[model samples]
Target: MDRLFRSRRSTVYSTKGIVSSTQPLANAAGTKILEKGGNAVDACIAVAAALAVTEPASTGIGGDCFALYYSAKEKKVFGLNGTGRSASKMSIDWLKKNHPQHIMPNLRFKSESVFKVTVPGAVAGWCDALGKWGSGKVTLADCLQPSIELSENGFPLSQCSADIWQGEVERLLQMNEKDENLKLFLPSEDWSAPKTGDVIINKPFAETLKKIAKGGKDGFYSGEIARSIVKELNKRGHPMTTQDFSNHTSTFVEPICYSFLDHKLWEIPPNGSGIVALLTLGLIDSLNRNGTIELKSMKHNSVEYLHLIIECLKISFRDSDQAVSDYEYFKKKFEADFHSDAEQLLSSKKYFDSRSSLFHPDHAITNKEMKEGVPNDMFKSDTVYFTATDSEGNACSFINSVYHGFGSCIIVPEHGFALHNRGGNFNLNPKSNNCLEGNKRPYHTIIPGMITTESTTNPAADEEELYATYGIMGGYNQPQAHVQVYLNMILFGMDPQEALDASRISLFAHPEHKKLSDRGEGSDGPSSNDITCVGVEDDLDPDVVEGH
Candidate 1:
């Protein structure tokens, strides 16, 4: 019996509604919304706001967001791109004129530098989602009330949050010993990180939240808050202006999709990397159909299965790396080609047959030699994902992030919030599709995922059955993790908790990415060239362990 059930905890069973988040406070806030007659979207807003307070290191009002909402009435999924754009003046030309030495397309400037900040899109995104899908049972102010109270009254720091906060504060301190941006996060007497249970408060953040709640989106975008943001940004030598904030608007776009087994997976289109996940699913389906890798023959978590999945991920990432661009570029090309390019690459049998020919059943590819594709830099993402499902069947998959922990470490001293470093993801090379440009969105790693079953009668129609609103929130790991979690539920028939608790495999070496190291701007640690340095738990089958 013990061997049969390996989950850390039992799956939660809820009838009226359910909310899941990284922080308990966020989960509670979302649940409270649902209990108070709010739908999934409204609950999501509450959860997102609470997370902005409780998980400040990874998320905040200063970051960006992406959402996938499953509308029960329409029986369809909707996509939201709440991402912000780069400053109109912060271009490669500006870099050449200001700081010439750090102009490399791949190289990043200091994380704390002002150039890394983008006009935050989260506030507008939050308002936009509520306006479009909210139940009207709760206003934006109501959804934000929990977060405001949490920020003003403070909450005991959890162990995981405390550890991450401490490390980030240490990192920021090293970058600038006297940097006032992170002063509030630092301890007054003890230089050490706050221990678990330590009460942390941010009255300024509460006030800021109150202003936004009362003034609505305009409070943040058009009024005093926007002015203060621009003033502080300009004071730090950043090129951001009030117009940048005023012009910000979140978009409702068509969600990119691919079919897997009995379900369709949906994600927001680029400049986000959501397409990578869809591409991976397409490749897997292609491989299974082509008879190159029959998943039916390989056991789940078997060495062969793991290898196949890893290879598919690398290949998909390589393609997405070359293809994903600003929404405007991707949309024009996709429409112009009528999606023929995407179909030929992912759906057509001919392309998969060719790709399948490259896979060798028994050997591992070298680091440098690659006809298929090598992994790029390890994705170092710090983000949070939450899901809210109402009794009415509407579900919202929400994700928010400040990019790296504590974002740019450029806290808005008056507002008590950090600015995100999303702009750092943009390339400076003119030849690249994702090249840094004024007023353009950067390549985003944050993505939310949705899965829905096909309609019983009209299988290809837009009216699919809502299955689940699920997502995993690591940067580069997101898509790969999504693949694994999908397989866990679909292939292995595990409940949510069991699916989540199942052991994970982390691939460190991407032939395309430089091995991670302290030397690199975004790297968290040392890198390894060996592709086989995959992280697997000790609890896995001995056969799988021995095979690796």
Candidate 2:
């Protein structure tokens, strides 16, 4: 019966330990670290860094990141939010000087040329994590060693990449006609498909690796690498400044925890979308005040659950639109009140005042699939999600991105790092959430996950201790992914892999993926994916949950 719900058939093993990500190369590299006796953190660093290099279309040093980690020894969770701020130079007034209306890349959304650029913070994030949590425990240098080498020596290209390059060659080369780095990664030529076991290499990337090996992550953040970035973006008339490079930093916040079933789900705070997932799961729990999740209940709950979640997301995003910004600005507009009480805020009736049964049980469900749908699209283009767990019960769940891939499509020359156009998500109409601002961090696509158990009694008693992180990659579906994964795994009692493999959803208030039935708000696009995409054909209500 589970066969109908399976997502992937491939799983590879590594001696280093264990790492699971969308990209096989990164997964292998992370496993290598574990095999080498590195812990979950060490393995995470190795794979995540390698993904930045080998999977540039998905993520790079210039992107943003969010994470949730569980320390078995401490029995607590730590949240690391790595969204970056705009360069001190990046302001609405400054950008509009050269263009009409001064809207950043309003025209370039289709071109993705040199004009679409923003400050990057992922490199600083990796460095910060390694420096503080890594230190002597796990040599920061060691975790990134493989990535450095891969960048310099270059790894072979997968068939999926070759195909994407073939499709997007013009798009890839539009920014830098003479740029060898872009050309090499997304070669314009098709060298035929891999024959079972083929090895491809990247030499320029190899040189890039060598530079990092000697300079450390800082080499990319503020030194020679930073210089290269500034030079390249400047050459293209981009407005980023050196201050942007130096100003990049990640934040450590307490994970917003929500109770569901017997476990608590945790996710990092804004500029990430993890809050949406936490709230959605909470609403589901609030609804199931008395009953265990049965398949019939699960199916009926899918639509109602989605209605509430989208409503919560609408509310949360409203806050994020206004309050969440780059850390500095958010600090002013959005107070760091760990007591924001996500579950309380979401369950409040004042918000999410919508009817249940947004979908019908009698109707045939749509066959909209999950995943980035691009496969490589998972990390190769816009976003990626990776999770790591060790026998010691130490776990880390991380989601990072360059935002729609290759980030803003502007490469900072010497830095060999591409800038992200995360700012593009903003609205300039003045009447919208997420308007552009100086020193404000763009809202992010990441939502890191964490798993933990609480004692059965009020005071204290024995309870199961489980630690893990699970994430799904998709733009609007991210937090929804977090919620669906938790439902199938915790509420339904499925394994992590199996839970994610089960049927899932792509909940949204917007109409991008959904097929809208009414002539109401967000009535554009194919509404079938949204309208017909809920509930299964012949499954029990609680037996199967969908979307992840």
Candidate 3:
């Protein structure tokens, strides 16, 4: 333990509370909430609002959010699906007529012209979480003060934000061939990106936050803010109505649970890809327990470890691509069968034992050769995730996203925020469960996860001990990162900060590999040779690289 101090980033240990986020200001905002005696839920919402101001390129009021709240009092984790749906009037007929290719031609278009925009659901999600799980110690207005002030008075732009802003602006400019909506994000009238440490403010956004602080969820969902959003969207060719915003509500659902070793993992159900993380972890656990692979003895990022992990991901992602979609639609189709199959896939020791027998320690299996499992399966700058835990042992694992950088980039001229392109995640195929429908949630990628230590004597006792609230953002990387982070701590025994700071790896489907649906029984799965197009950070040991 003493020698571990040699690492640059140490694990953050806080008994009072702790908040982790990609941006520093967002962390400070959540910490302030804790200082004011607010509980984990309040701190989580505060951190989310602050991120809207500080990390505008990645998340905002226009995006959707999902959360896993662990309540100390109840000793249970609750899942909140705060994702928004398409306009109540949207349909496939509209798509076929307007977008014949079944794809958004210009994803950067203004909100009115952007067909991929969805009613922003983050505000409703925040309110739902607070209303149900908050400590009731602080008013919503009190929790939002920091963000409102930041948006109104402005904060210095960090180097990373400036660079991303510039890159986005450049991309939009090249595609649109005009500066139609670029002015909304530029720090000054010259339309230049802010330099690092430069102060920038969005007075309109601040005013919008102020309205929400005063009126609660209705502040954003109804009346003035709502009217402005709809009017602007309608004017831009997309016919969103006030009803779409008003009817929006976040749902509190039972979390999907997976037990690993002595701990239980929790995640939001379909429409969010958290299941992929659970599935990937289950496969890894099964492999290690069966001695098909011994992870504890292998060095971090060793070829053996990376290969196995990537291969597991291949199966997880393939399942997710084919099966994951809106929960309502998925349930109506698969019902209890999905859960039954998932249990066998995850908890059935015999099931995994058979699967593990296929892997060769020294050789790689091709995707074509990789066999499909029984019945089940599983953005970019597009998302933001943060974790908050309070002294009461209550923890909140929160994730928010607009589905793409700058979202639709159509800043509501009145409210001063972009609409999310989450609807773009839906497909055009009528046979697909995730195909677009009016008032239907799209296939979502943002997921928040929680892990709690299991109780020995009684299953009911598990709720009392709060474990950790954590998640990694960045679209598809979310699930893969989840597996890596869990392993770094659970299997590798690294501390929290070290686990997060550790180098990461990801595996892409071999280019030549056909889509899972295209292959038949006994057909080759997603690999061509022992070496796949796997991406591993350069910081690993020399031997791992040489071996790969």
Top-TM-score structure, candidate number: 1
TM-score of candidate 1 on Cα atoms, chains taken together: 0.90
Candidate 1 residue runs with Cα over 4 Å from true position: 1-7, 104-111, 174-181, 329-345, 371-380, 457-461, 509-533, 537-546
- What lDDT tens digits, residue by residue, belong to model 3 across residues 289-408? 877777778877878888788778777665565546666544554463454445455676665566566667787666556655534443004688998999988899999887677786
Order candidates by lDDT, high to low.
1, 3, 2
Q: What TM-score number comes out for model 2?
A: 0.77
> RMSD for each model, in Å, please?
4.6, 7.6, 5.2
Determine the backbone clash count of candidate 1. 4
Q: What is the TM-score of each predicted model, taking all chains together? A: 0.90, 0.77, 0.87
- By summed lDDT, which 10 consecutive residues of candidate 2 come out lowest? 371-380
lDDT of 1 by residue, 363-430 (tens): 75543344423122211169999999999999999999999888887777678788898888776655
lDDT of 1 at 376: 25
Global fold similarity of model 3 (TM-score): 0.87
- Model 3, 416: alpha-carbon shift in Å? 1.6
lDDT of 2 by residue, 110-159 (tens): 23534445667676666666565542456666777788777666677665
Better model by lDDT, 1 or 2?
Answer: 1
